[model samples]
Target: MKVIADENLALTDYFFADLAEIDYRAGRGIQAEDLTAANALLVRSVTKVTPALLEGSAVEFVGSATIGTDHIDLAGLATNHVEVTHAPGCNAQAVAEYVVTAILTLQPERVQAGTDFCLGIVGLGNVGSRLAQLAQRLGWRVIGTDPNVQLPEIENLSFAQLLAESDAISIHVPLTHTGQHATYHLFNTQTFEQMKPACLLINSARGEVVSEQALLNDIAKTQRPVVLDVFEHEPIISRNLLDHLALATPHIAGYSLEGKARGTQMVYQAFCQHFKREASKQFESQLADMPVLFNLKQPLSTQLLPLLPQLYNIRADDQALRAGLNKDGMVDAAHFDYLRKTYPLRREWAAYGDQSF
Candidate 1:
């Protein structure tokens, strides 16, 4: 079998090289012509997988290495008899840790997080649920809202209640436009008004889930700390927003080394299972020792402040993105894509010594 896959997918060759002939290409430019001779296609969030792309192709299966499927037309692919599989919750640990780090880093140093510090989570699925677990472990009361699920990490609350009660909030919902819990622009003027005046807001999930205009307006009024990893128009982010944000990253929240490896492995296993073949590659072999620079047993204030920055100075990502966007004589989109394509890989907290973090 010959499989056309995204060049960004980690371990694509390591996992599939022996099993099938591989054709790796940039995700954004992958076109219908590329799949004409392929038996399968593999993708990431940047690739749009629709029936039109599959119509005249020989591809019978499509695998997405990332957690989100917003770029794929699932129903259309299914209708066309093309099997599809995605790695869900693969980057949950990475994203969860990112939320924790971002929250503590963005909040005032005077504010010590103890039992009373409440973290409101919107959409308690993979990433949100993981964040809830981390918050409870780190001694933050977590209140969540997810209208779709009957049971969540904690008893679910109304979206308004979560906004009003949470000292800081993190968003982890999918972007939907028509459902009852349609998250497109979910954090608009009305919802933003419900939030605590000074509540910290973080969005590592989809960009459109929060209305950029409404957020810009609300933050202008309340002067709240907002850490954004994703933007509405990804490659074309706002210079104005960058100036005001506590931290801004180019959607690298889930780019941890372990996360990418796990995602690639998950989809590889699924592909092998579907084809009734044995999958020999294991992702753990790709993991290495995480450098522990600070004592975890030390006080959270001093230890974490030094430790998180050593492991991941999120501000560096902000600076890098800003520099890339403002480069002389280059398009913002090109710079943005180049930054992501060449992002320095980071390992998640799980990769640190087996001791409790």
Candidate 2:
């Protein structure tokens, strides 16, 4: 079998040689002509798989090493008899850690003793649920809103209630088309108007799920801060929005080294299952190691913002990207690709050594 992998995917020679005949290219400029002879295509979020891109190709299987499949045209692939698979919840902890860090960073004042605060998790899926658990462990009152999950322990609340009552609200819902009860610009003008002026808003999930205009307007109206890891147009992030936000990242919330390894392993396992190959045993050993959270000798106080950044300095990555792009002009697609391809080594909390404080 011949396989073509997106350059951003970090599969080594050992991995590709073990699986199939592989051709890897870094640029996401994969034209149909490029894949005319390949049977399997491995891609990340950068490549858009559509009929126009693969109409005359011999590709049979496509796998995306990322949580969101918004970049993949699933229906079109189905119509063309090409099977597509994506790694869902592969970076749950990575995103959860980022959200937690953002919360701590934005609300340092709330770290004092005997201060009770509520964390509003907009969606209670893999990432949201994990985030809720972590928030509870950190002594925050956790409330979740997901019409799909009817758990007795997770207090289900209306979207409006979450916005109005939460001290910090973190969005984890997927972006869907209109008419869906779950989400589609769910955090628009009305919802933002209801939110507490002191509340800090976070969006690690899809960007368009929260209306950009509404978010800007809301930020203008309140002193409450907003932290964004994802944006509406992606690589073409809104300069106005970035300048206004307290913390802004280039949708790398789930791009930890550990997360990428997990995503690759997940897809590899699925491929082995589909082909009934003995590749499972080899794939098991290839599982990437997650970053260890250095154990603190003594339990630190609730003021974790400073400590957390030292442990996982997300801002450094953000600043580096901004600097590389000059932060003063439109970054071309090639520049964006370079930024992602040469991304910094962001490991999960579990990958660090013993903690100092």
Instruction: Give candidate 1 misplaced runs (Cα > 4 Å).
Output: 108-111, 150-155, 291-302, 327-331, 354-357
- Model 2 scores worst on lDDT over the 10 consecutive residues at 294-303
Please, what are the lDDT tens digits per residue for candidate 2 over residues 1-357? 788888777553555567788888763687788888888888888788887887777787888888888778889889888888888888888898898877666666655422378888998988898887667656678888887764465667977787778888998877778555757788888888888887888998988888888888888878568888777766676457666788877677887776777777777767766667765434336545645544455333443555686667767766655654445655445655677787774766665653311
lDDT of each: 0.83, 0.74
Listed per candidate, the RMSD to the true structure in angstroms reads 2.3, 3.3
lDDT of 1 by residue, 277-308 (tens): 89888988866766665456654444555567
What TM-score would each prediction reach against the true structure? 0.93, 0.88
Off by over 4 Å in 2: 12-14, 26-28, 111-115, 281-306, 324-328, 353-357
Estimate candidate 1's alpha-carbon lDDT, on a 0 to 1 scale: 0.83
Total clashing pairs in model 1: 0
